[model samples]
Target: MNDRDVMPAFDMLMEELDAIVTHLNQQGAQLMQAKEYAQAREVIVKAEAVLAFQAKVKALQEEWVRLSVSSSKKTPRKKQPGQRVMTTMLKQGLRTPNEAFMLPILQALVQLGGSGRVIEVLDRVERMMKEQLNKYDYESLPSNPKELRWRNNAQWARLNLVQAGYLASDSPRGIWEISEAGRALVLEAKE
Candidate 1:
């Protein structure tokens, strides 16, 4: 069955389990009042087991949510030879390489005084590289149709920059910042 069908079923199961636990607790209390200590202990132990199972199920549900959100953000690239050939054929003379965004991104951050919001940085970078950007760059990405291809390339470039230590890895979310090394590289380039 699909997620929509299974999710409600899981919810219903959890609710039923909660009711069962409540019943067990009430039964244990009644047994305690009647001085049946061993029976009360057994009921409490069963309730604890059910609670533990519920905890595990909740953890699994959380993990599933995390995985689904991450997977939906980006499409995975296929390494098949046929897919590679098709992509190469389709992309001929169209988009700029990811590296093309590096200098502009660093420059944009520098201009913004070391850090800026993602959209602001990208806007500045776009103005800087206007002539270099091609028609294909303006098109939407296949993976995320709402995002432009060049913006996605720029984001990939930012990821590479972070990996190479040219950008700050611990910067606040939605803000892009250049590192000291990145600034020095820009200075060295100017020399």
Candidate 2:
């Protein structure tokens, strides 16, 4: 099966696993209410095991997405002068793609000493990419009217970076940190 098909299946499995864990927790709570301490402990243990398995599945899914993205990076295409001009004009009207945020984020974090608050990193990234951002990027998102489209796209890019092992998945909320792989990527680019 293709990546798209596999991803949805994995998502369904994760949802089912989450439901199982919730049910197990509820059963454990009921057992506790009945004063069946040993049964409650067993149920809790089962829930923990399911949670661990869920984590493993999530890791595998993230790895798959990372591999897919890495494999799908396209080589630059050759075009006639007219086509090139048209492409440039078209690009200016379109919002920046999420992949474009990866390096900027890593660079911003490195400049911040490998970690910083989300707002700080985003601000740095904005300054770095000021010339590249287009008017479309400045518009508000439909789902979140208070948030700009570019900021929402940047947050989604952050999620991709974390899944790809370039950002820390376990960093405290509101903080963004680069991983060793992320640092290596930036250094490699410099060379």
Candidate 3:
């Protein structure tokens, strides 16, 4: 490829990498405040990517410096650090049906106790949630894969308990013991 074509693509990739890095460095608390789980998940992935890109950039710079010195060419220009080019944190995610399905189940899982569903678990769930999770006024959790509303306080307890890996429901039958993963979620929540 011609130098002209090569340079622009590299420049564009660098610009994108820079933009990703800026986004990734946001405070952990700010990331948690994300309104949706999917969005938060994207941010975490992007943040990790940013860190990766920075590592790549650093490695490239080191190699470039070595090559330039060997070839007796002037060092390539370097962009100043910490300035954004693309400049936006766009809204994340499509409200697709599949996401809609998994979301409620996940949110419901979060509500029920996730690890354990004792009184303390319920209390913690209520507190972590910005909204109330009671029977009468329980708002819809995010939709899951099947478009089930994941509605009902019964869901609140059931999903969370199930997700915590404790208490697998046989549906109209009964729940079994909590799994180790369930125990972990409960323990983490408590901590």
The number of the candidate with the highest lDDT is 2
Q: Model 2 over residues 1-191: C-alpha lDDT tens digits?
A: 55645676777577668656755765676578669999999999999999999999999999988878432445656876545221111122267766678789999999999999999999999999999998888887654568987888789778867865779999999999999978987997799
Which model is ahead, 1 or 2, in terms of lDDT?
2
| Candidate 2 accuracy as TM-score | 0.52
Point to the candidate with the largest TM-score.
1
Candidate 2: segments with Cα more than 4 A from true spot: 1-93
RMSD of candidate 3 to true structure, Å? 17.5
True lDDT of residue 164, candidate 1: 57
Using Cα atoms with residue i matched to residue i, what is each candidate's TM-score against the true structure?
0.53, 0.52, 0.26
- Collision count for each candidate, in order: 0, 0, 12
Candidate lDDT values, in order = 0.78, 0.79, 0.43
Give per-residue lDDT, candidate 3, residue 92: 23
lDDT of 1: 0.78
Model 1 lDDT tens row, 1-191: 34544455556566557656755765676578669999999999999999999998888767766656322333555677544221212233357766779889999999999999999999999999999999899988655668998999799879867865779999999999999978976886689
Instruction: Evaluate model 2: give its lDDT.
Output: 0.79
